[model samples]
Target: MKKTEPHSSRSQQLEGAGLGFLIGFAGLLAFQLLGELVVRLLAIPVPGPVAGLLFMSVFLLVRKRTKASEPEPLLNASSLLLAHLSLLFVPAGVGIMTHIDRIKDQWLSISVALIIASFVTLFVTAWSLKILIRFMNKPEPE
Candidate 1:
């Protein structure tokens, strides 16, 4: 005769089989919803998801400071999401294909705008990095 331990073996199995992804996904949605609510209530111009992300980031920082006891489910979910991040771009790719004709008409302008924006972004990022490095290297005042 054998005795089975009265633990969450079912949950453990489900988690191993990717239930963590669902929980993580749910957590993401909850944060997004919370963000949306805050944006609506505060009448902020920022997008709801962005606000939610900011909130989530602050929560993580606070949790870190408090030395959270349990494992962070978001970390696993985020890893799984990142693993298949490319899939998220499919809708945009499909949209482009759907609007290929419209895009064809504006191709040159779009190309120029994209190129200019890319260069500007690179320049700004480089400038910011230079300033940051200078600030970090500055000696403390006596």
Candidate 2:
């Protein structure tokens, strides 16, 4: 009689997802630490983790562009995390609950800021895309 291995397709997928999460968490920590070091060295106003995130974004973009023909393991891994990303906001929601009094005091300003920022971001994104499409379609100068 042949012995059957305990590993199965579902188990493999679960393992992959778990590994992906660990990789992403490690990447986040490494990037944040690097960003912190750079910020301290350069005396930048932005937070280290924010800078690190931007750096990671650029790295991911470049990697994707270069590996256009290849399968994107990192991208896929990150996408898996993103699929359930709303869960990540639960902590933030809880924190907000704790700050209800402060939120109430500044609700007006916070709402106004959020509305203005949303509109501004939408307008800028649309305008930039429009410009990019036009540039891409424009005829080369003689």
Residue 57 accuracy (lDDT) in model 1: 90
lDDT values, one for every candidate: 0.84, 0.81
Q: Estimate each model's TM-score.
A: 0.75, 0.54
**Model 2 steric clash pairs:** none
Candidate 1 local lDDT, 1-142, one digit each (tens) = 7989769988888877576677778888899999999999999999999998898898788888888563357877877778998999998887876788988899999999999999999999988877887789975443
Worst 10 residues of 2 by lDDT: 69-78
